[model samples]
Target: MSVDNISRADELVPSRYAVPVGDIEVLVISDGVLPITASTLATTTPPAELAGWLDDQFLPRDVVDWPLNVVVVRTEGRTILVDAGLGVEFPDFPRAGQTVARLEAAGIDPGAVTDVVLTHLHMDHIGGLLTEGLKARLRPDLQVHVASREAEFWEKPDFSHTVMPQPIPDVLRRTATQFLNDYRGQMRTFEAECEVAPGVLVSRTGGHTPGHSIVRLESCGERLTFAGDAVFAPGFDNPQWQNGFEHDPEEAARVRVNLLREVAATGEALVATHLPFPSVCHVATAGDVFRCVPAVWDY
Candidate 1:
């Protein structure tokens, strides 16, 4: 099961939402949604509390339809793609992995991309690049940037600190291995931070994975940060709630809290992979915890 691989024009409804950060232009595209167990979202919270929070958000009690988002940026004569989204190979998640088709629907050619910035090597982030439909279209000199530590971590990933449903771990390893082997030549690994364009910057923030990173867009006076897996839906209301997929739960919480505080203070827009569609918002403090203030939709 997979999303329709037909021509792009068939998707009449808009799947990509546009936002402006001064001179830079960004499009937050939908990669569809992933159905995940509700418990995985707040691994450490008491079941009752988790259920209560879900109820507050009006989400289901058992399986939750988690939104998957990827971003695209245009700046300094460069076209940059953030994360690749869950590619079409995974049969279990038939609705997801729509990055390629949606990219086309947005009038973005797969070959037009000049660079790709991966927040991590997780399958959901890098799998779209592995599909032959995309592989056959990428430019020969396309640059794929990732944190050095992230690439190294996948060599011998440590899952002892994490918990995931059965078969997921194995699928992740296989997909990651395939990605690295296929694109190692095109990859450009960075140590701390790198600028993809005049206004687009990606910096490593270890927690979700040893090399998990976030992208920051700054132009003129506007700022926006793509937190990747650092912040989930439960994160603002319960910053300490540990996500089961985090390689280091404690550090993930620290990362989430700090990132939330930063956005809340600076009043910058934030987006992430698993947050709701488009996932564009500003953060504000609500006592010790935080609150997600959804940005007013532009147009």
Candidate 2:
């Protein structure tokens, strides 16, 4: 279940984009790709409406490929891994279990991971916590941080009522049992807007998933926010479009609009877990819609 071992430094990193913010190096890592069907998008936004929005953007009428991104914050005291990628469970998924290998290839020993921040308990964001044996993999000593709301929601037997793609609710229920058994004392919860690390703060960005949070990093004069699933693709600003997997489409759309305005006004570099590969980009407002100008960085 492991990828071929290669030199950590010499191995080609997958579309990694890094920017030095004071003493911290924010490296955006791509786990792989997620393919969503038209029906999937319709679950949140009507298919016809979504197609119309896509047409306006000049995008294709086929499937949408959302690349999985994990942000790595390297600071002097700790190596903070923000959200593990979708784990090895989905054999059919192209990038289901590559997060660990990619991090290792980038010179990051799994044992050195001090914290695994869970934006939410969605399978794609947290399935990487366990090994093939279902044992915790990130340093045995590392702590798993999650929002208090995220823990409570996943623990509920009726958690499915809040998630889309009905199959996902079942996945969360099963994963919850495994996580509790393996991550016992290692799991901790945080209140809203708490600073977990130097230059890193967790902010509530619900609507995508209850307890879903985004991490903000600021150092010197540079600022970068890992927006998690708050804004699904740049298409979010299309007040006419709704995200494909949002828990509350209306609320998610509202939050995204506000966030887009905030980040656009702040002029900070931002990254998302499901944006295209090397997803670091600067946000800008265009008329009523928002546009993403990918940050130019050498691989």
Candidate 3:
């Protein structure tokens, strides 16, 4: 049968996708997309090999669009937000910083969010916690939780020795300080692993940052994992590939490989920040590598 013509919206709008884990609901809210060069992804992989992989996948070898996903978990009485997106003031990427608007569209009130769990302290992950001026906290009354090691590192950053460029460390330090000061009393940190909410647990994965972590949601008998930036797109298939943004490439690869195995074995759903839109998927072992099977949308 021939398909009928359909009208498309003129203006772009933020997208949101929801999934249920037993009694709890998890919403994948889009902050926006960031266009990054393919070379920036697999930093250590040879250019020829990287190009061949992209070609095989039918993807562009030049620039790849990475999505910024902010997750919101709704339970019986609390609204928990994971990894705030880049806020309005990020000069580098004008298309980003739409987390609040997207969250609102998903029926979540920013003010009603009782807790904000940060998987790490990268600018893209923590920028939405404050207002444009960076003078005040956006979710004022909420308890903001980050990894203890992450907090310590940012508290006194040594720019001379890091994976990022010279200016990034300074910028990150300034923003992180502002966020910590603004929410002084409400900020909390965890060491290895701890439960932020009833069934919401944060576990330190490290590598991407000294304090990088992943959030696991358990409700009834179902489970969902917010993998953060630990395992990006093509990296999932090649878990040992070095990522340009990782603080320690070797450690990052180890963490990713271990996590992928666990996810594959247990059959838990994973939501990665840089994966394709509506980034919920399952992992399957493919010989020594792994593959991501995007979850089917349910009506």
Please give each candidate's TM-score: 0.97, 0.88, 0.90
Query: Which portions of model 3 miss their true places by more than 4 Å?
Result: 1-14, 133-140, 158-167
Positional deviation of 28 in candidate 1, in angstroms?
0.3
* Better candidate by lDDT, 1 or 2: 1
lDDT string, candidate 1, 1-299, tens digits: 23344454677666789999999999999988889899998888899999999999999999999888999999988999999999888878988888988988888998999999999998899988986657868999999999999999999888997778988898899989999999999999999999888878999999999999999999999999999999999999899999989999999999999999999999999999988888999999999999898988889
| Residue 225 lDDT, candidate 2, scale 0-100 | 84
Give the per-residue Cα lDDT of candidate 2 at 44: 51
Q: Highest TM-score: give the candidate number.
A: 1
lDDT of every model, 2 decimals: 0.91, 0.73, 0.80
Off by over 4 Å in 2: 2-13, 42-44, 55-62, 133-137, 157-163
Ranking by TM-score: 1, 3, 2
lDDT string for model 3 (76-99, tens) is 688888999877666577667777
> Tens digit of lDDT per residue, candidate 2, span 52-171?
866876766676666788878888688898988887777657645567767776777777888878887777887777646334345677878888877876666443324355565667
Is 1 or 2 the stronger prediction by TM-score?
1
Clashes of each: 0, 0, 0
Clashing residue pairs in candidate 3, if any? Answer: none
Model 2, clash count?
0
Candidate 2: give the clashing pairs: none
Model 3, position 132: C-alpha lDDT score: 54
TM-score of 1: 0.97
Query: Which model scores highest in lDDT?
Result: 1
